[model samples]
Target chain A: MARMLSGRLPDPPAAVRRGPPWAGAFPSTLHDQRVASLLGIALGITFGTCFLTGLVSHFMQHPPNWLSWPSRPVWLYRVTQGLHVTTGLASVPLLLVKLWTVYPRLWERPPVRSVTHALERLTLVPLIAGSIFQLATGIANIAQWYRFHFFFTVTHYWVA
Target chain B: MSGDGDGDTGARADADAPAPAGAGLSVGGFALRVVLVAAGLAALGYGVDGLLTMPRATRPSNAAAWLIGGIVVHDVLLVPATMLAGFTLSRLVRAPYRAVVQGALIVSGAVALMSLPLWRGYGGSVDNPSVNPLPYGRNLAIVLGAVWAGAALLMIGRAVRARRTGPG
Candidate 1:
């Protein structure tokens, strides 16, 4: 409306053509790609450990017929379970740091430009919600803070 | 559908895209996406089916609330709080001291967060003394004291070294 009144068509910014950045488009060098990528690698290692070890521990407790629960290496369950807790604890820091880094992008303008863009944005719902849920429930469970109504084990498994 | 922690694949994909070879809609890339999406959907369906088998075992409504609450807590509380802290620190701290301060803050914040449940002894009970048996708060203080002390020493060393090799 202002441009129309002024009788001057505003030139489109180059960024208009490419689409929105997943990185927070704000000006800051600290949380750029390098830092994000490094934090990402840290998170990957910690979370990956939690997932694998948690799986082993789960299977040992609720051994299904399809898969064989390991009987040998007497310390197997102990080690896996220990690693699970350790990695999970470590992930608390890594996850929070990573979120802090990329959080600015959450407010990037024109959130979705097309069907594909919208779908991509939609995918973040699960990613964010799932990680947060896992950590919250896991922490609550470990702390024995049984304030929630749902059974932790079953819900945690499905969520995982 | 991505499960990776810090699951911002899009954030990392923006740099130097190999679009000359059609990284997005090339025949191979499209097929890969199709396979990945199919697998993700299948996993989703399987999870839903699995949940149904244990209705009483897992309270659906409450679990859903917790899931949603996690997002709320993160987006509403965590981000804003950190932004405020960062903005305040930027205004207060000088450039030369900023890195040390920031590094110290990050490490300190992470340690405190990871230690909260244990430090509070929320799970400790008369029935189980072994659960968080130690004085976590005191221990945490001791640990943080050491961390900060080390940081202080490092900063002093840097200052001293800089003085000895003055650029001016």
Candidate 2:
């Protein structure tokens, strides 16, 4: 009765009482979910294009036994490759800005809240590693930087 | 992640409260989460399998190094450095021109980073005119010049508008 009258809520449960260290590092008006969602949507579209276009390039290179890609469109390969490179390029800023917006939350302590949260976070490990792999390798590939021993195309394909 | 490290002291009323126990997962959402994890693991496993089978071509060891290295390079070097630069630079600009300045920086930074490789011309081949044909360094300069020109106009317009509207 006294606590209710005073309008103070009870403390959070023992397991997850502390707030994340980076909760207030950024301004909400500028770096909230709205901003994150906007960048995420853009990344989704560009990365989707890159994915589909990547398949087209792979097929063109390998010439799959299952399906005969049309030769009628002389410019088909050109178009897909152009879109892939451009969209991949576009993703750099979107990825960077998206990171800029939400990277503050990387400091979350007590990293796992529950079993479900832990599982969800586990999935992100491959995701972040894979995406960054693609981005770095792709740029190196275009520049002929050859930073890795693995054949770029082979690794890039499997990862994607 | 209740990123509200600063506390709930009147920052912005009714912003997202820290997610509660269960993290607000509903039954359907929980099912979806299960599916997502399963699919992610499947895909990742497949990728690893492909890397392993083609030992010579893929070189899984080196590839794994690059994969983890990307995360490190981005998390440790790229993201923090870029964010800190932006944060430090933002303090120097006045309010009315802030958006324009930030926008120009982002645009030019992306353009420059994307185009730098081309300007370096390491990949350009004499036999293949298709690759890096033009003078990319000069071209990049022109693009940046135009970008700053547009930014200047935006800043002037924003300042004029701010002056007319009076202080908010």
Candidate 3:
């Protein structure tokens, strides 16, 4: 009763309520530059593949007067479209992980101290937003979810 | 920090962090910048062209909403979920076998995400026989079963190795 009345009975033991040493540590260390680099390269390759394939699909669907889409490969559209979706799906995991690895920097102090730093940070707006737009639109297009009134092909082609 | 690193040496040690020592321009760096500029211009030009030429029926507002919605969903939901799973796996599994477990999880997760549409019968089309003709659900099950089996074998191998090497 006396102890309770006092502001504090005694100081809590040091480290008494400490969590496990590795409790907060992510299994894949995000700080590792090598891992980030490798993941970035992989993500880049996947995006490149998706972009090129997407362009092919777009051209095939809306051929220019100068270009002709071959009808011999009846399965061409299916194959390219499948590849586009698959690559985009695969990118979901890669992009998530890549973003996770570099997420620490999002909260780094002195957010923008220099001109170069500001420019660099600004670039992320497009890089990230565009990537998200591409993947999201691609997935929705593949699923044929037309919740949006916009034509999928035209918007997707532009967003690509 | 070395000058001899191969393939895009201009890539900073951490993309979001400060550049490492000795970071400077190289052929790879120049190429990368050029490619990025070209791609950016192309995307912007194409997007603008599409918007200008788009049919009157297409709603720009809808497109904008979808674009923003995708970013929100990914950043808000998917990233955290993935981090939680990774943390949980790390806590549950020993270091020796963690890679196998993580690999299995990633593969299964990707396959599962890709298969959801099929599982929901969204891919089926009565009009076009060529599209989505495969038995997706069954195929997904088979692939997942094989993945788990492989993971099990990997675990067994790690266990045997640990026994031989005496646990670390």
Tell me the TM-score of each prediction against the true structure.
Answer: 0.82, 0.82, 0.71
Best candidate, lDDT: 2
Write candidate 3's Cα lDDT for A4-71 as tens digits: 22222233344432322334443456645666778878876777677767778878778899999888
Chain B TM-score against the true chain B, candidate 2:
0.77
> What are the candidates' individual DockQ scores?
0.31, 0.30, 0.18
Q: Order the numbered candidates by lDDT, best leading.
A: 2, 1, 3
Best by TM-score: 1
Q: What is the lDDT of residue A136 in candidate 2?
A: 70
Candidate 3 lDDT, tens digit per residue, B115-159? 566656674357877655678788999999999999999999988
Task: Indicate whether candidate 1 or candidate 2 has the larger DockQ.
Answer: 1
DockQ score for candidate 3: 0.18
**What local lDDT score does residue A25 receive in model 2, on the 0 to 100 scale?**
59
Candidate 3 shows a clash count of: 0
Estimate every model's Cα lDDT from 0 to 1: 0.67, 0.68, 0.63
Tens-digit per-residue lDDT, B17-95, candidate 2 = 2352244456785555445445556666777788899989999889889878888988899876776866776788876
Question: C-alpha displacement of B24 in model 3, angstroms?
Answer: 6.6
Give each candidate's fraction of reference contacts reproduced. Answer: 0.42, 0.40, 0.31
Per-residue CA lDDT of candidate 2, range A117-136, in tens?
Answer: 44445555566677778877
User: What is the C-alpha lDDT profile of model 1 across B53-123, one tens digit per residue?
Assistant: 67797777777788789989988997777767777788997766667777888888888877777887676
Q: Which pairs, if any, clash in model 1? A: none
